[model samples]
Target: MVPEAEFTSYYGRPIVKPSPWEADIPAYLFAGGLAAGSSLIAAGADVTGRPVLRRAGRLAALGALSISMAALVHDLGKPSRFTNMLRTAKPTSPMSVGTWILSMYGPFAGLAAAAEVTSLLPEQVRSRGPLRLVGLLGRPAGLVAAVCAPPVAAYTAVLLSDTATPSWHSAYKELPFVFVGSASAAAAGVGMIAAPTHETGPVRRMAAAGALLELAMEQRMERSMGVTAEPLHHGKAGRLMRAAKVLTAAGAAGTLVAGRSRALAAASGAALVLGSACTRFGVFEAGQESAKDPKYTVVPQRERLEREGPVRYQP
Candidate 1:
């Protein structure tokens, strides 16, 4: 059993405050990851001549990207000032980097999806001069989007873990893997729903690998945090986390046995998507809970002070 931490604060008030941002932040996180990972899937399908999967992947990437942008702007209070995010390029600023990544990713992803959509149009429509150019530019634009996808998918973890929040900051080491795995799983889930059964082999494999990686990394993250991990496993956040784990496990198992049955594939894919959503929400909620508890802030500081034998006074 993990040792319980006890610490005091003024009037029993929380030392660290929870985020002011609402659910939209976590929703953006999920959508951004889904878009990034789906772009990668589209790139792979494009290279392998899987047109059906490629189209599906491109469309998913575009849709998710749109949702992510909407959620981000909505969370910013003054939506008109959302463009201020692009005012400066600071290497030390995760938000700045993430904004730049999105700026590049959104257009490329949109172009890719547009290209796919144009290709499916009737001959008379597709043969138009402007449309032909878009079709020609689509593959390269998508490839460029895919190149940026990994960072887009992984950067949110850095953004969250770099914050002052105890639970998120403490789990920094493992958070990237967790986020990437969840993103991959979500993208694969979208593929399963949108692509033909025969072209979904890669999607299924990615889903399984992603789920396993997320589960393993999450377990290690919680265990290593010890008492600090309590927020992740208790109360409302805990419930969501538990549900995510169950769904992820079930989805992974179903993918393995889904075979050629489109129905099973669809079900497993849906589960993985929901599981990934749960994970994002759970992580956000856990960080909030940890921030709101004085023990989470004070106990860690006390432990550090004790371990370091107190700061020596320079006389």
Candidate 2:
């Protein structure tokens, strides 16, 4: 049985201080992942000429990207000092690289989303020369963004991984898969809600891939952290992840047979959405839970400290 415990810092070093950033930071991370996934779905629809899905996916991507930008800026320690983020790009540093990627991808994605909207307009409206010009130029932008977007989506996991945040850093492999799956699910959810489900073949495929990867990573993550993984396998994270896996599996399997019928599509979509959101929240909660525990921090530190004994004073 677990002993009654009081919270203490990790090795007496702060495990977490309330991040000074506003809610927008986390909100934006979710939104941005959604945008990246949606854009990829939209691109797939564009190739398949499923204008309904294409348009809806594009719009969702754009709206989410815009919101993400706002949230990211708001999260900057010194919003005014944001430019300093550009000073360098270190592979070991996820944030620095992420900032650069976002800088390049955001506008291009916005433009791509805008171009997709033209496909939905009346021919007369879409015929406007300037809009046509924008559409032509934006086409490449969308493709570029989509190809690049997956990394951007994955980078969030890396960002959190490098931090002292519990479970996040140690569970690096699993975290990226989690984000990837969640992003894909989010994209499918938007497509199912706004577009005709009959043509959501691409979305369904993405959902299948997402669900598979998430479940696999989660299992591996659980096994990877013999001791540290305790927080993830217990409490809210475990419960939520368990629920997510069940829902995601059910939803993906349903999609395999959910042909044309709108009802089946909607239900599957909802399940996927719930699963994805739970994954994100579970991850966040798990990190916090792990951080709050002394055992998680102390045990790891003690191992490290033992490996390298305390510094000796020079007489």
Candidate 3:
């Protein structure tokens, strides 16, 4: 019968514990997904006889996946416990799915990179048939990873939404789009940096799509939040989103103007990369902000418990 506001903080703790995940984890996730997608795109381009674009795509996939895997392991509660994620597939848990997705993605990406780096190796070290075989087999790894990447990138949104994180759960529809956009931008950035200007057309196109999508979703998320939106209005989340918008805009504009200038394309690519990072940071910070305020968690749950009754643990 009493008001829930009277009980502030969890166990008298003023701050909600941010997930054990470090700041790098989300960025890594973004980068990894983008890489995987790029690899698939590269393969497609190569098959279609777009040799220059193909190389760029492969490079992007490799570099992005490397950073993503590193960040992922670094975020584990017990880095040694990483294997447990693959112990079994649990549809109810996105983390478990992500683990397996990463598991398959790692080796596949490594092999593909080795295939692409034939020139980087010494004459003796340069592999031909076997390496090409690996490339052929591993070529799909990026797209394969891409299939799982969206879930890996956005499932965190669901995870936090289900928890006490403020507007995150309420804005579930927009989370996937936000993550997808960020991932695409990150991959396109890598492509722009590694490939020649003539080959970066796809990267530019993908980055523009991503930037526009993220900007639209973010604006909508802000407007849709109502009371829960306040977390995004102040502090780090606000700053990050604001910065992301500006950077995304700059990158998009630069990509349009870069034409065949590899250097200009590279700069635009860099801007997109920064923009993606900012978006990840902003989302995480927003979750933290939602968790920090007692009202955000308490009010909603209190309403649910009152209307539907406290969930009984039968087991």
Candidate 4:
């Protein structure tokens, strides 16, 4: 019997070109999710009268967003390239929509953080005109950021899945959930780390909920993706994914019994943050690896064709 033929591409090159993005892109993805999650936490804390948690969440949102934008600009090799994306709006384009979301979110997040900072000013300075105005606007700004948070957290997944990359495209159904959950967990981590232990009840709940959602979505994605999921289970991507699962699970469990111990809360918070980062990096690497291997691209097409049969042209 003849052996099944091996799939090969021209000159042994990848069937699909891997994205030119570097490590900065993954950092950008992680930071963006962190910012979105933090904004939501901040808004919730504000409504619930958790001043310490509010301040921490707002500050973390702004800081993470700044890092995210900077990483994106650095990856693009020019700040102008980012701004250029804003010159036109394309409803069908995920990149365009994501850019617009970031543009709207940044100012609100910054304003919220700035308002939070005004409280840090000396009493006399804080009581002054401009600072007082900023402080007064804080609630509104934070609310706006919260309103935009879900889209910001999920848009990166949309952007990735919209790409031609086999792993990302194949996992589109669950990628957004994974990203949003990761964002929430990371944001909850920030609150746990920075807020008073007494004020962390909501944050702990959020952490548990987010971690569970992320874990479930990721498992579903892998199961549904078939061969495309292989990249997520091997090499550097596999290592990162394994670390992410362990850390996220540990962090969620720790939050259940963290109680009033600041050390335990902080440690658990750190684990969640690290786990979220690992997840982003792992997903990014898996997509890159999948794109590099022709089998990932060609086999999926072949299977789809086999399952659906060939398209017929109409007269």
Candidate 5:
């Protein structure tokens, strides 16, 4: 019997060009998610009367957003290139939508964080009219940031999955869930680290919920992706993903017992943040790797064609 012909593309070159993005893109993704999640946590803390948690979350939101914007600008190679994206909004374009989201989110997050800073000023300065005004505006600004948070956390997944990259495109259905969950875990970690143990009940619950959701979504995505998922399971991507899973799981479990000890809470929180970062980087690497291998492209197309048959054109 004749052996099946091996799938090859022009001396084994990649069938699709990998995205030119480097580490900056993944960093952007993680920071953006963290910013979004932190904003949400800040809002929650505000409502629950947890001053420390609220302050930390607001500061983190602005700081993370700044990092995210910096990374995106660096990846674009010019600040002007990013601004150009704002000239016209394209509803159909993920990049355009995401840019707009960032624009809206940045001002609110900044205002919220500025308010927090004003509150930290010396009593005399904070009691002054200008600082007092800023402090008064903080809650509303933080609320607005919370309102904008979900899209910020989830848009990067849509942006990544909108591309032709096999792993990213194939896993589009689950990527958003994974991203949002990771964001939640990271934000909860920040709250846990900064808030008093008595005020961390909600944060611990968020950590456990987010970790579980992220882990579940990742598994489901990989299982559904078939051959395209191979990149996520091997190489540097695999190692990072494994680390993420371990850290996230351990952090979630730790939350259950970390209530009594500030040190344990801080360690658990750090693990969750690191795990979230690893998850983003792992996903980024997997997409890049899938784009580099011809088989990831060919096998999926072949399987689809076999299932759907050839397209017929009408004269």
Candidate 6:
């Protein structure tokens, strides 16, 4: 019997197109997730009467949101054109839904942070009618931000998965949860760094939970991709993912022992933040690599055809 013929491509070019989004888009995704998770944690802190945690969370959410916005605009390349994105509301479009979510959440996140900062003013200043009004509005604004946070954090995964990108689309079922874990870890890291030691119990627990979820989901995601996962473990992307795992493990361990030590908390928090960033960049880079290699796209389709057989089209 003759052996199966080897695969070939036209002039060595990729059969599947790479994503048009550049590095800025992934950076925005990381920052936006951090903002959403932090907003949720801040609201929880407020509800639980953790003043220090509430303040830290609010500030972290605001700062990350700001950075995320900037990254998105930079990716757009034309700042003035950004407003055009909001002109239309299309339910079927993930980008449109995301734009609307950001529009709704950004103001609340900003106002909530502003209100917190305002509350820190002198008693005499806070007693002013305008300031008092702002203080009264802060709680509701924060609550609104919290309500919108989950969608903001999760929708980016949908956006990536909706694309024709092989690695991302293939891992759709697991990517959202992976992002959730990273987001939770990042937000918890911020709280650990900024909240008082005694007030960080919730943050520590969150860090642990997020780290575990991220690690587990990431492993399953890679394994489920089969040969398509090769790009994830081979080169620059692999190094980043490996480093992320190490940092995540170390940070999780440190959280266990940090207790009331500010130094240890800072170290652990930094590691978590870096690990989350590495995960985002690594995933983005892996998708690009997978697109560049035709085998990732063609082989998977071939396997599906072999297993299920070609569909019969109606005459």
Question: Which candidate should be chosen as best, given TM-score against the real structure?
Answer: 4
lDDT of 4: 0.96
Clashes of 1: 0
- List clash counts for every candidate, in order: 0, 0, 0, 0, 0, 0
> Which residue segments of model 3 deviate by more than 4 Å?
1-17, 119-129, 135-153, 299-315
lDDT, model 3:
0.71
Q: What's the TM-score of every candidate structure?
A: 0.95, 0.84, 0.82, 0.98, 0.97, 0.95
Residue 82's lDDT within candidate 5 is: 93
Q: Which candidate is the best by lDDT?
A: 4
Put down candidate 6 lDDT per residue, 11-46, tens digits, no spaces: 988888898889898899999999999999899999
Query: Which residue ranges in model 1 land beyond 4 Å of their true spot?
Result: 1-6, 312-315
Residue 21 accuracy (lDDT) in model 5: 96
RMSD of 2: 3.9
Better model by TM-score: candidate 2 vs candidate 4: 4
Question: Against the true structure, candidate 5 has what lDDT?
Answer: 0.95
lDDT of 4 by residue, 21-89 (tens): 999989999999999999999999999999999999999999999999999999889999999999999
lDDT of each: 0.92, 0.78, 0.71, 0.96, 0.95, 0.90
- Look at candidate 3 and give me any clashing residue pairs: none
- Model 6 lDDT, residue 130, Cα: 83
Winner of 1 and 5 under lDDT:
5
Model 1 residue 280 CA deviation (Å) reads 0.2
**Model 3 lDDT per residue over 1-315, tens place:** 876446476586744555555687666656765765576567666656666676667766777777776777677656778886677898777677667766776666566566667645666555566755655564565445445445545555555555545667767767777777777776777678777877677778887888888788878877766667777767988898788889988998888889999888989989988888888788778777776676666666767788999888987
lDDT of 1 at 254: 89
